[model samples]
Target: MAVTRIAAAAAHFGRDLDHDLGRIGKLISDARAEGAALLVLPDAAIGGYLADLRHPDPEALPPALKPDDPIFEHIGALAGDMVVCVGFCEAEGNDRYNAAVCLTGAGVLGRHRKVHLPAAEGIVYRAGDSFAAFDTPVGRIGMLIDYDKTFPESARTLALDGAQVVACLSAWPASITNAAPKMSQDRQSRLFDLYDCARAAENQIVVVSSNQTGAAGGMRFLGQAKVVGPAGNVLARTWAKAGLAVAELDVAGEIAAARRVLRHLDELRPESYRVSR
Candidate 1:
């Protein structure tokens, strides 16, 4: 296949849609400067995430927009030739969903509504039912939003559907109960990187993990954006700061190299393992 430069962002977004759009434009410009073909922005890139996870105020929730919102068109226009995966809150009648969409200059390639929800998310957003991968100029790509990447099956399903790269978008915060004085020592910080590496290693696919940094209401987000190789190696990273983690990779070539001896997907024993609901 072809070598592609991919970027994962670590930036903060808030309630102001106009401000968020401007921040996104800057990130897009930065990625283009790095010659990135694919760029993955954090969850809630458009409207921001809930202020308090345990007690989300419905009155102050992120602005919900339709799937075909003109905002997306603006993103597509800005994306031009580069493929971009960004997170937003989707509005459908009375129901709302935490979702991600993949797009380029032409139009949208695919979209994924977050399926797995942490306790507080359900109070505001409806859960999605399935995981699917779609073809893009970059490759067959899949997306996961925030808590979705916590489940091993989530990324596995995307891999089974033939995704070469999985973009994990998050507005994940530091531990609510056990806050660490240092960002490096934070519990959620470790788990975030662990999940990214594990998902890529297990699936033998590239993982572009992007997260929001800085504080939002009572929550303090950890920005450990990175690009993980199929062997679970962190190719590039921006740890505990706001920046872009860019890496040039030959997706098909790397996957092939990693799976040559131990093909994890092909060697799966689905029948022997007990399936969970």
Candidate 2:
């Protein structure tokens, strides 16, 4: 297995599409300079995310773009050889979905519309239906947006579908109801890292996670971008600031080593598991 260098970004972005693109371009260039094979940007990095996720105004939503929009082409142009994963608000006729796409200089490799909606997000965006992994230059990859990573089934489905790396782009905020004294101390901050580590360890795959930082609208984001190993180790991480978390790993070797003794995926008994509701 080849060692792949990957990066996850934690940066603040807002409603301006052109400005966001410029920021994305600069970040891509920087990642390329560092020889990163994959770069994952925060959710809604294309046009920005909602200011107040808990009670977002229906009429005042972030600008939504079509999947085949020219902006993605612009992003693709900046990608060069590195695989880039970014989130955006997807517009499909009258419905808008929280979505993320993986692309390279060639074109889009795969797309994922967020299947899980948190709090008032359900009021503004339509939920997606499924999870699937796709081929990329670096490895088999999958995507999840924001609240989607909160569920084990989401990442599990991707891993089961042959995803070696899962890029989770999130516009996740600090505690909405109970504001913490420090960003690091926030409840959601802990949950964010916990989920990232748990998902990677449980499935024995690499996890690239990114989130928004600073405040957009009234919501303050926890900018803890990170790359986690299959052994549940945080290979690289960024604090509550706009920055990049970069790591180099032998993806296939790491997964093989982690699963050598305890093959969690192979040992699962799906037929016996049941959900009451």
Question: What are the lDDT scores of the predictions, listed in order?
Answer: 0.96, 0.92
Sequence-dependent TM-score of model 1: 0.98
Q: Worst 10-residue stretch by lDDT in candidate 2?
A: 51-60
The sequence of per-residue lDDT tens digits that candidate 1 reaches over residues 44-64 is 999999999999997999999
C-alpha TM-scores of all predictions? 0.98, 0.98
| Model 1 ranges off by over 4 Å | 275-277
Q: Which stretches of candidate 2 lie over 4 Å from their true place?
A: none
Instruction: State the lDDT of candidate 2 residue by residue for 1-277, as single tens digits.
Output: 6999999999988888889998999889888888899999999997788878778877778898988999998899999778999999999998999999999989999999999988888898999999999999999999999888999999999999999999999998888899899876899999999999999999999999999998988888899999999999999999787889999989999999999999999999998898788
**Which candidate gets the maximum lDDT versus the true structure?**
1
